[model samples]
Target: MAKFQSLKEAVAENLRDGDTVAFEGFTHLIPHAAAHEAIRQGIKDLTLIRMTPDIIYDQMIGMGLAKKVVFSYAGNPGVGLLRRMRDAIENGWPRAIETEEHSHAAMANAYEAGAAGLPCAIFRGYRGAGLREVNPNIRSVTCPFTGEELAAVPAHRPDVAFIHAQKANRRGDVLIEGIVGVQKEAVLASKRSVVTVEEIVDDFDDLHPNLCILPHWTVTSIVEVPGGAHPSYTHGYYDRDNAAYLEWDRVSADRDLFTAWMKENVLDAGPEIFAARVKEL
Candidate 1:
């Protein structure tokens, strides 16, 4: 059921204004190219979802594309704070954005619950945490079997989920090799999914059957985008561009600099630039 399409075509066809989208990737295999394409296409007012919102989210937020962000932790990974996100929240440079914070465990459970088609994720968390006092979604449910109380959060059923995988076979089955994270559950939980991969192989013949493989039926689009996860490494394909991440902390610290960087690197550039970026790496 997955159609092979270009990144531009996939983004345009699948993503739209005011959609609740999740670009789910951990420290690795982040879908930077797809996010850039969405930015170039001028997608706006998204309710973004992720476990750890990193630089990719920062770019989208800085560009005034996000109306709200649902996440557990947000930062620049090893570098520092997400300046753009902070700016949007504090100064409202582009526009004001709302935030829903949660624990990492709750987010994982929420994604799993969504994948299981559950209404909410029930887990033992938020104990002594102030998040319960602030977030209305963080509610308590009494155990049916026991008299104990538990925490519950709404499941993340996004309109569309985006991820970068290592490879996809001709049948559109995607192979996600390293640090799978919640990419699988995110895709399964979403109404639609767009996957960008390093390459398209004839088939995943030699790979183990137990590997993290999303069947063609689960994905809406499979796009061959070499070096698509630049700045975030694709296992076995390229190394993480740490220098770029560091530079982003500087570039994003200033509104003018952030806009200029985005215009030059993302707006003026295309997916082809990603391939060139990793050629020397």
Candidate 2:
């Protein structure tokens, strides 16, 4: 069952060095505060997993928190490149991290397969793709019904997964309303999970049946962290911080500039800063 805890306590207890972790959101509800907390606690050598890795993963890579990254697409959303991730790969700034790339379809299937406790995910893909040549994890499988060939990748069962949501009830059920991704599968596939929410209420009322709501049993911890998804907007709380994204393009371009920004904005900042930053928005 889920335990209500501080982000610090939750991260410290659940995440560890060399563990495989996934911080997931589609375009919204990105778990920035939890990632920042992981960085602040100096968790290292993680095998980070995400379908679309944006700025939070970039920051994690810049901070040398990852030894490898498994993802489909990685960038700064509308912005160009994840400069820090590129530096790690090209220049070995922190360290040259290993990458296992896959297509968006394959990643989504893999998460579902993991949630089902399958050994591997078999999907029809990589027909004309070059990714199979580079990513050794992608292999070919033969179908029984026909002689058709299919793509196969190992299931993505992370050690821990993190997600941000609109709210949770007193029972610790997380409610995600907008732009749902593979977060539900990612959490179900992981050994442990953490959720940061805008608030916790007595009950989850008038919830849509189709929306994602993770039961308390599936989540390891729930942290009440309003504005935790900042830079990436929550559904109804605030708009996406396009200015912050633009500023990151500048701050992350140079090594020294990025380091300074992290020191002031992330490393030195506390959890309250997240709510404060959101309030300012």
Model 2, residue 226: distance off in Å is: 0.4
Q: Model 2, range 22-125, lDDT digits (tens) per residue?
A: 99998799999999999999999999999998999999999999999999998888989999999999999888899999999999999999999999999999
Q: Where's the lowest-lDDT run of ten residues in candidate 2?
A: 204-213
Would you estimate the TM-scores of all the predictions?
0.99, 0.98
TM-score winner? 1
CA lDDT for candidate 2: 0.93
| Candidate 1 lDDT, 65-127, residue by residue in tens | 999999999999999999999999998869999999999999999999999999999999999
Clashes of 1: 0
Q: List the residue pairs that clash in candidate 1.
A: none
lDDT against the true structure, per candidate, is 0.95, 0.93
Q: Give the C-alpha miss distance for residue 21 in model 2, angstroms.
A: 0.4
Off by over 4 Å in 2: none
